[model samples]
Target: MPRTNRNGADTKFRAFSDQTRLRILHLLRAGELCVNDLVEIINVPQPTASRHLAYLRRSELVITRKKGSWTYYALAPAANAFHKTLLECLGQCFDEVPEIQKDARRASKLKQQGGCCPR
Candidate 1:
């Protein structure tokens, strides 16, 4: 069962429970990326990006693969299902949320920019 104490799973849940991590998840919703990509896109420092990513990894929300000297992170397959469910819930919550529309636009722009980040 999932733990209720300060165990690994609980700690990971706490990590994903943060706004920053959620934003990172949202960004990763469209596709996979690296820490540098996140840093540039989110306009945060390398350490900040690393912290959020580490949390996501611990939560199994993100998966990392090594490519030579670099590590690329993407939403784990498990995370994809959860993300889909989240979008469905959000869709149910609002008939016309401008914020969601705006976010979609931004995400589109990010994708067009090669996900290198526009920050």
Candidate 2:
């Protein structure tokens, strides 16, 4: 049997350490989005987006749903006290960053244009 690590602070911190992951989390702050939408908005390749998303999933920072061939991801509902507060802090801190703001604008425009899977 494999041992489950009790301390997830390191895992959560690692999840927030990458620029791509941070961008993804900022994008997801608006709402759930498909992998294609993330790829388009972030201007990265499909595999790149998937790879970062996988990292987020492993960190238990995001949740997923599959519709047909598309997979959608959103911030995971607060799993516990620590994650809840951390997510709240992340939202507040990233909301003011210029790069994150730009990414949100791009994502908003893409959604408005129906660039990918429509909401």
Candidate 3:
């Protein structure tokens, strides 16, 4: 988990402390997405979704790419073996979580329907 000395493993764990952040990360497990995609799937306001994404970015748990006017985010490659394991655990850890499951299903449907995110 050696992203930088500024934040240690504790910060990474803290990134999971918020349910919104957890939901965002779990949804991102599938692939990169625009913020609006998350906002729609999670039923959160755009600002709220962006805030959580910013938190994850600061934690180095995710990375971003700019496509024209939109910003897309995805799980970053782990900085080390432990970090790799932690990222892998995200999907398994929340497997039975009702909220997480609902998010995933909605995300799938969004893709199937060609996504209304306009990204």
Which numbered prediction scores highest in lDDT against the true structure?
3
- Candidate lDDT scores, in order, read 0.65, 0.86, 0.88
Give the winner by lDDT: 1 or 3: 3
Report each candidate's C-alpha RMSD, comma-separated, in the order given: 5.1, 2.5, 3.1
Q: What is the total number of backbone clashes in candidate 3?
A: 0
TM-score of each: 0.64, 0.90, 0.91
lDDT of 2 by residue, 16-118 (tens): 8999999998788788999889988888999999999998998888899988877889999888899888788888888888888888889989988976884
Report the lDDT tens digits of candidate 1 across residue range 10-45: 555576567567667666766777777766666679
lDDT of 1 at 23: 63
The sequence of per-residue lDDT tens digits that candidate 3 reaches over residues 8-97 is: 787888888999999998888899989989988999999999999998999899999997788999998999887888888897889799
Q: Residue 115, candidate 3: how far off, in angstroms?
A: 1.5
The deviation in Å at residue 56 for candidate 1 is: 1.2
Sequence-dependent TM-score of model 1: 0.64
Q: What is the TM-score of candidate 3?
A: 0.91
